[model samples]
Target: MSRILLVYTGGTIGMIKNPETGALTAFNFDELLSNIPELRLLEHKISTVSFEEPVDSSDMDISDYIKLAELIEVHFEDYDGFVVLHGSDTMSYTASAISFMFENLKKPIIFTGSQLPIGDLRTDAKENLITSIQLAGLKERGKTVIREVGLYFEYKLYRANRTTKINAEHFEAFESSNFPPIAESGVNLKINHEKLIKPNLRKKMLVHKSLNDDIMVLKLFPGLSQQTLSYLFKMPHIKGVILETFGSGNAKTDDWFVSLLESLIERGVYIVNVTQCVGGAVHMGKYATSERLKRLGVISGGDMTTEAAVAKMMYLLDKNLGPKVFKTIFETSLRGEMN
Candidate 1:
C-alpha cells in the first residue's frame, strides 16, 4: 500500500457550515475519513497534518509557505506522495512558490481545494480530495508517474507554476494558458506523460525557504501617469518588477517611459516583460513598441503566468545574482514555470 500524507493547510475544503449561524468553520482533519468514508475504499495508508490555526487563502504569506516546505522536508522519507489543501484564491501563488522551493522533487505534491464548504450538499471537495490522494499514490513499475508540484481542480491536473486562478465564482477557477493539462480525470485517470516533468531521482531534494517578497507587478495601461510609474520603480526596497504590458509584451514607446526603464535597469532593478493576454508568449522585439524594451535589457517572461512570474522573481532575487547572469537565468525555465 502506498503511504500518502494529506497536509491540510486550511481552505474551503475543510469548512463545515454552522447549524445555528450558517457561517462556515474549519473542522478537524481527524474527522476526514469518517465524514467521507469512501476514502477507505482506496486502501492507501493515509496520514494527515493540519496548521495550528486555520488561515483563509487571502491571508496566506511567505511564512506560511516556508512552514509548508519544512513540513514536507520533515516527512519526506515517510510518504510516497503529498496532497495539499489550500484556498483557491491564492492556490496558484502558493503552488508556484512551492514549485520553486523544492529542487529535484521525486514525488507528487498535488494541491487541491473546493469552491464550497465540504459539508454542503453540492460541495466539490470530496471528489477533489479523493482524486488528489489517488493521484499522489499512483505509481507504475515501482516509479512514480508525477514527480513535480501540480494543482488539481475540475478534473484537470495542471503544472502548479503554469496555473492562474481566472474565476472568483466558478468551480473551474484555475487556468494554464501557456501549458496544457498534465493529467485529466474522467472515466479513467489519464496521465499525459509527454507534458509531465521528469526529474532525476538520483539528486537529493533541496528545499528553498528564503523568498524575497520585495518584488512588485507593474501592469501597464493607457493613460497611466509618468509620476505613478516613477514612484513605483523608485521604491526603496523594490528589487524586481513584472512588467505586464499590452498584447505580445508591447508598451508605450514614449521617451519618458523608455528613460524610466533605462534608469531602473541601470540602478540594478531587474525588469521582466510579460504579456497581459491570457494565452500568448511575450516576444520582446516583435513590435516596434516592444523592440526598445529588449534593447534596454528587459527580460522576457515567455508565456509565463503573472503568478509564476512573481514567484520566480522572488526566488531568483533571494539568490542575489549579477545583472547579466540574472537576466539570463530569469529568461530560462528554472522549474518549468516558463517556456
Candidate 2:
C-alpha cells in the first residue's frame, strides 16, 4: 500500500465544533478520524503530524515556508506522497512559495483547505481533504504522475505556483488564469498530463529555506504622481517589487516616474510587471505607456499570477545575483508557472 503523509499545518479543515461554546476549534487527528470515519477507507495508509501551536493563514511568514519545507524533506523517504492542510487565505501564496523551494520533486506535494470549518454540516472541508489525498496517492507505470507541488481545492488541481484565490465565498476559490489547470474533477479526476510539470531526474531535490521577504506590490492608477512613485521605488534594500499596472502592462508615461524606476533598476532592484486584472498577460512594448517600464529595466511577468511572481522573485533574490543576471531567470519557465 502507498504511504501518504498528512502534514496538518493548521486550517479550517482541522477545526471541530464545540457544543457548549458554539465555536470552531482545532482538534487532534484522532478526533478528525473519529468524526469522519470515511478516512479509514482510502487506499493508502495515512498518518498525520500537526503543529504544536497551529498558525492562522494570515500569520504565515517566510519561517513558516521553511518549516513546511523541512517537514517535506524529513518525510520524503517514508511517504509516497504528502498532503498539506492549510488555511485558504494564504494557501495560494504558501503553495507558490513551496513550489519553487522544492526543486525537481519526484513525489506529490498537494496543499488543500476549505472556507468553512470541518465540523459544520455544510462545510466544504471533507471533500477537499478526501480528494487531495486521493490525488496525492495516484500513480501509474509505477511512477508518480504529479511530480510537483500543487494546490487542490473544490474540484480542481492547479500548479501550486500558478494559483490565486479569487473569491472568498465560492466553492471554486482558486484559479490559474494564465496556465491551464493541471487536473480537474468531475465524474473522474482528469489529470492534464501534458500540462503537468515533469521533474529533472538529474537534479537532486533540495529545499531552499531562506526566502527574502523585502518585497512589495505597487499598483499604478490614473493621476498617480512622482512623490508616490519615488517613495516606493527608493525603499532601502528592497530587493524586488511587483508593479500591478493597467491592461497589457501600461504605466504612467511621466518622466519623473520613469526616472524613478530607472534609478531603482540601476540600484539592482528587480521590477516585475504584471497586470492588475485577475486574468491577463503583461504585453511589454504593446503600448507607449508601458514602453518606459520596459525601457527602464522592468522584467515582463507575462501571465504569471501575483502569488507566483512574488515567490519567484523571492527565489531569484535568494540566489544573490544582480538583477541584470536574472533577466533570463525571471522570465524563463520554472515549474510551468509562466507562459
Candidate 3:
C-alpha cells in the first residue's frame, strides 16, 4: 500500500461549526479519521502533520513558507506522496512557491482545501480532501502517476504554478486559464499523461529554502499618476517588480512612464511584464505600447499567473543572478510556470 502524508497547514478544510456560537473553529486534526471515515476505505496508509498553531492564509509569510518546505523535505523519503491542506485564498501562491523550491520532484504534492467549513452539511471539503489523498497515492507500473506539485479542487487537478483563485464565493474557487489540468476526478479518475511532468526517479529531490521577498507588484491602470508610480518604483528595498499591464502586456507609452521603467532597469530592478487579462500571454513587442518595455529589457511572463510570477521572483532574487542572467532565467520556464 502507498504511504501518504497529509500535511495540514490549516485552512477552511479543518474547521468545524460550533453548535452554540455558530462560529467556525479549528478542530483537532488527530481526529481526522473520525471526521472523515471514508478514508478508512482507501488502500493507502495515511498519516498527518499539522502546524502547532494554525495560520490564516491571509497572514502566511515567508517564514511559514519555509517551514512547509522544510517539513516536506524532512519526510520526503518516508512517504509515497503528500497532500497539503491549505487555505483557498493563497493556496496558489504557496503551492507555486513550493513547486519552484523543489528540484527533481518524483512524487505528487497535491494541495486542496474547501470554501466552507468541514462540518457544514454542504461542505466541499470531504470530496476535495478525500480525492486529493487518493490522487497523491495514485501510481501505475510501480511509478507515481503525478510527479510534480498540483492543486486539486472541485474535480480538476491543475499544475500548481498555472493556477489562480478566480472565485471567492463558489465551490470552484480555483482555475488555470493558461494551462489545462493534468488530471480530472470523475467516475473514473482520468490522468492526462500528455501533460504530466516527466520524473527522474534516479535523482534525489533538492530543496531550495532560500527566498527573498523584497519584491513589489505594480499594477498599471489609467489615471495612475506618474508621481505615485515614480515614488513606488524608487523605493530602495524593492529588488523586482511584476508589471501588470493591459491586454497583451500593453502599457502607456508616455515618455515619463517609459523613462521611469528604463531607469529602474538600469538601476538593477528586475521588471517582468505580465498580462492583466485572465487567459492571454504577454506578447511584449506585439504592440507599439509594449515594444518600448521590451526594448528596455523588461522580461515577458508569457501566460504566467501573477501568483507564480511573485513566487518565482522571490525564489530567483535570492540567487543574486544579476540583471542579465536574472532576466533570462525569469523568462525561462524552470518549473513549467511560463510557456
Candidate 4:
C-alpha cells in the first residue's frame, strides 16, 4: 500500500463544538478518521501529524511556512503523497509558498479545508479529503502523473502555485484562474492527465527552506498620491514589489509616479506587475497608461496570481540576483503561471 501522510494544521475541517461555550474549535485528528470513515477504503497507509499549537490560517507566517517545508522535507522520501488540512484564510498563500520551496518537485502535496466545521452535517470536508487522497495516489502508464503541490477543495484539484482564494462563504473557496485544474471529482474522480505537471526526472527535487520576507505588494488605485509612493520606495531593505495594477496592467501615467518606480528600479528593487483581475494576463505596454510602467522597467507578471507573483518574486530575490538580472527572470514564465 502506498503511504499517504496527513499533516493536519488548524482549520474548520477538524473542528468540534464545545459543550459548555457552544463554540466551534479545532478537534483532534485522532477523531478525524471517524468523521471521514470513507478514507479507510483507499489502499494507502495513512498517518498524521498535528501542530503542537494550532493556529488560524490568518496567523500563518514565514516561520510556519518553514516548519511545514521542513516536515515535508523530512518525510518526502517515505510518503507517496501528502495532504495538508489548513485554514481557508491563507491556504492559497501557504500552498503557493510551498510550491516555490519545493522547486522541481515530483510528488503531490494536496492542501484542503472546509467552510463549515467537519462535525456539521453540511460540511464539505469529507469530499475534499477523500478526493485529494485519490488524486494524489493515482497513477498513469505505470507512473505518477501529478508531480507538484496542489490544492483540492469543492471537488476541484488545482496546482497550488496557481491558486488564490476568491470566496469566503461558499464551498468553492479556491480557484486557479491562470491555469487549468489538475483534476476534478464529480461522479468519479476525473484526472486531467494533460494538465498534471510532470517533473524533469533527471533532476532531484531541491527543497529551499530560506524565503526572504522583505517583500511588499502595492495596489495601484486612481489618485494614488506621489507622497505615498515616495514613502514606500524609501522603506528600508524592501527587496521586491508585486504591483497590482488595473486591467491589462494600466497604471497612473503621471511622470512623477513613473519616476518613483524608475528610481526604485535603479536602487536594485525588483518590481513585477500583475493584473488585479482574477482571470486575466498582464499585457504591459499594450495600452498607453501601462506603457510608462513598462518603460519604467517593471517586470510583467503575465497571468500569475498575486500569491504566485509574491512567492515567485521572493524566491528569485532569495537567489540574490541583482535587480538587472532578476527582472529578466521574473518576467520569464517558468511554469504555466504566465500566459
Ranked candidates, highest TM-score first: 3, 1, 2, 4
Candidate 4 — worst ten consecutive residues by lDDT sum?
330-339
| Segments of candidate 2 deviating more than 4 angstroms | none
Q: What is the C-alpha lDDT profile of model 3 across 111-210, one tens digit per residue?
A: 9999999999999999999899999999899878899999999999999999999999999999999899999999999999998898677888789999
Select the stronger candidate by lDDT from 1 and 2. Answer: 1
| 242-291 per-residue lDDT for model 2 (tens digits) | 98989999988877788788888788788899999888899999999887
Whole-model lDDT values for every prediction: 0.92, 0.87, 0.92, 0.85
TM-score each candidate: 0.98, 0.97, 0.98, 0.96
Candidate 2 weakest lDDT stretch, 10 residues: 27-36
Write down the worst ten-residue block by lDDT for model 3. Answer: 320-329
User: Residue 33 deviation, candidate 4, in Å?
Assistant: 2.2
- In lDDT terms, how accurate is model 3? 0.92
The residue ranges of model 4 lying beyond 4 angstroms of the native Cα positions read none
